[model samples]
Target: MNPRSTATAHVDTFARDRLPPPDQWPDLRFDLPELRYPDRLNAAAELLEGGAGRPVFRTPSGDVWSYGELRARVDRLAHLLTRDLGVVPGNRVLLRGPTTPWLAACWLAVLKAGAIAVTVLAQQRPSELSRMCEIARVRHALCDIRCVDDLAEAGVPGLRITTYGGDGPDDLLRRPAPSTPYPAVDTAADDVALIAFTSGTTGRPKGCAHLHRDVLAIADTFSRHVLRPRADDLFAGSPPLGFTFGLGGLVIFPMRAGACSLLLERAGPRELLPAIAEHRVSVLFTAPTAYRAMLAAPGTYDLSSLRRCVSAGENLPAATWRAWYERTGLRLINGIGATELLHIFVSAADEQIRPGTTGVPVPGWQAEVQDAHGRPVPDGEPGLLAVRGPVGCRYLDDPRQREYVRGGWNITGDLYVRDPDGWFRYVARADDMIVSAGYNIAGPEVEEALLRHPDVVEAAVVGRPDARRGQVVVAFAVLKEGAERDAEALRAFVRAELAPYKCPREIVFRTALPRTATGKLQRFRLPGDGYAESSAREDAGSPTGRETGGDRQ
Candidate 1:
């Protein structure tokens, strides 16, 4: 099916018209029969109707909704959107809320009505929300009553907002809705379905536009091939629905496989560990930090039901991976994905996993280690990682699109090495490499060594300005409770672990590390102080270190 030749169902052509010029777009390939979607398709209907009568979402309080029930809710919301709110096809609708059934229903409703979904984290400040609304040109919003304050205060001109999950007369759930099924919009398969912005903390956000076909392609490729699930699998995770990783893992992947997912609104490791045990979740998805935190309190969780675990949103340190496997006997499936490509593109199944390396590309995807000039580098040479598949990067009216997609491949800003065995090993982010005395040192390598230390729970290494050495390695470490705060001792430990030149010249002790909403470490946010106030508390012989909640998904 020639996607470009089909007539769009959108009444508003703003989104499609603003896409990067066709010449700059990466090569889009439908490499599998399953990826060849119909010309006229609504991704929500395709995902929901296939699993009718099957359990789809489960709440922590024992509440459950089957596929049929969720579909009816979504249909009602879709009908209300077009009928009452005057929403038309291609209208951008903002969705903000915690991870709940209502939030999921709102997302599907927007897609079902052929309206573009603009999902944002509930934690965003009013200023941030305002900036996002301006960037996407979003006016209509479906905000949870708890989150309405920020959206309303964002002051988006003429925003028609409908509050849900409230008892008020104007609340969306309070409105009388028809129970009959509403026909899903007949949108072109290439029509944009949702715009997922980056989860970084600083700078203006970059919105990644994804098509309706991409929503389903991720499930067909990664979910079906790498993390194969049975119909009875009970999934659970800590990521918010706003993040693409969570949207796929907690919702799309589970629904595509006819499995039920337990949605936790407060899903830190403390909350998620018990939820997995209470709900008997068979499949778990979270960042490497959450996995390590769970490993910290191992005996308390009855993790007998967990058979498959996935780690992403940050690099999975080999020491953390090995510790989890040794404790739970489940190998962490480490994968690298981006908001640009949608979901996990490179990952391995249970036995296919290599301990320290992100595995080969998934079926229907091609990846390579490329140098600065976009040419492929020899195996084992560190270079920029470039990949392309059914789903590729499409930024929403941002000039960075030209930089992200180059020469028919999405040049993910990750530094990687393709070993002779064809597995891709993560080095560090391209910008995270430090040049110390003409030797290139990857920060994650130093962090990985620090994580292997018994007392260190979390570590982040960055390049600090050093006039003599060009740039010196600096590490911020969060130690376990009661562990000694001896920076020199830790520096010596890394010297013994790796080459002495790679060792951090200074170690700063902190109670907690700064992270973005999706739990990725914001290395730029690290403070310049040699030691934080927590170190002063340690000097006074007082306990320091804060409890790590759930990581961003």
Candidate 2:
């Protein structure tokens, strides 16, 4: 199909037009000159081009699919999307499914066919899905058969939904393979390839548009420099492919190195431990919580084959790192990434890892601690974390773009301090700062303090409304098996480790803290007395709250 019509060109320009002015964009850097991408590029071609017979994906049941085999499947799906479904360049296609091999193929196929792939978490409800469709103006959908009813419930106008992975003859996997392969569509490097939605911990989900070049930039920088993967390395992770963390760790990184990945339908510690042993997986990507869970049953599985472990999606407590290293003799590679920037911009691997620090910026990226005026703060002073790199904030037609990309720096909503040695230590999310009785406290510092207690399994801290103090530190905790959930003991334990005002005035024990699909702690979900979004937005400009407008946007 000829996709070069003027109408098609206009349709594709929608995403590019929404980007902030060139003057506001971050200064993109590619240290390795070879990393400079061509103006006309397709991310799918870069990821799945030619490694002919190399194994690319392996199932838990021991089924292996080679790169050539996967590419053939992607070609057939691309033909189906373009020919049968009438998907055109720049049309937004919603992809809904778990991290299955077929779902992965479908994602690449959408990109290959010159459509924007909007991937949603498999567990997202109909309401969230509907809002996403409405916001993105999604034209078509490729959903797992189980999710079709919900997609239909979304009631998006003129939305054509196709089912995949079910018993129906029309299912994507069951459809007849195309007789002739469909070549990848030619797309500009700046063309919007994917629209990733944020976790929406605060309010509504905001879409972040990434270009074809941004896709390969992450692989070329982090995967090439820090991860240093081998062709035989088998990447495995717990995050859903919809999450950029998972997309980079499980798919792009491995593909860039000609390595394969083991896709788990479910990646809880119970499933992950056994699979690592059975598959002899070399690289593991997961959150800190999973590592703690895996420690509980370390004797039950043989994790001796694991050479590298990557932890992200949430703050990695020093205690979690120590416990994992003490148990496995492996230093966990800790990183901090965001949906706006596409993937990890700051991280440390192996000998460079500091127990509590998020390490230096990845090659080709620039990070610094800055104050309200976007000026760099002195080392060891807590301030807003700002970053800029090959990729930066480009929200899909949202005014929040101004707030996110101010003065050419992506002000991530994080509180961090860079030490004299250049390692950045995470304090808390800027919105998560707690103020009580005229003292400012970082919620994560208190969470870290609580985590130091032997009986505490999990902890999340937030500011609760107080009659006298305006707001007081409150904690929600998950206790170890058979441990007492006494609020006083927990408070006292934290008080000993931190200032008394920083300690949780009240600790409520829960079986589990609320978390996102990618295992990020959802502080907004913590119980608070009338901590309304309107009130928070009003205080977003306050200094003690440290909620800078740039950070929140």
Best by the lDDT measure: 1
**Model 1 misplaced regions, further than 4 Å:** 1-3, 200-202, 528-553
- Model 1 Cα lDDT, one tens digit per residue, 212-233: 9999999999999999988999
Question: lDDT score of model 1?
Answer: 0.86
Model 2: per-residue lDDT, tens digit, 1-553?
Answer: 1112122322556555666666656666666765677668889988996488999999998889899999988999999888888888888899998788888899999998888899998887777888888878897999998768878887888998899989988887787767577888888777889999875523567888888888999998778888889999999989988888898888888987888999998898889999998999999999888888888654678889899898987889999999999988999999988888888889989889999999999998889999989999999999999998888887767777777777778989899999999999998888778889888888878888998898888888889888889798877777788886577777777878987778777777777876666677667666576544421111221111111232121
Give the lDDT of residue 325 in candidate 2.
96
Error of 1 at 507 (Å): 0.5
Q: TM-score for each prediction?
A: 0.95, 0.92
Each candidate's lDDT (Cα)?
A: 0.86, 0.82
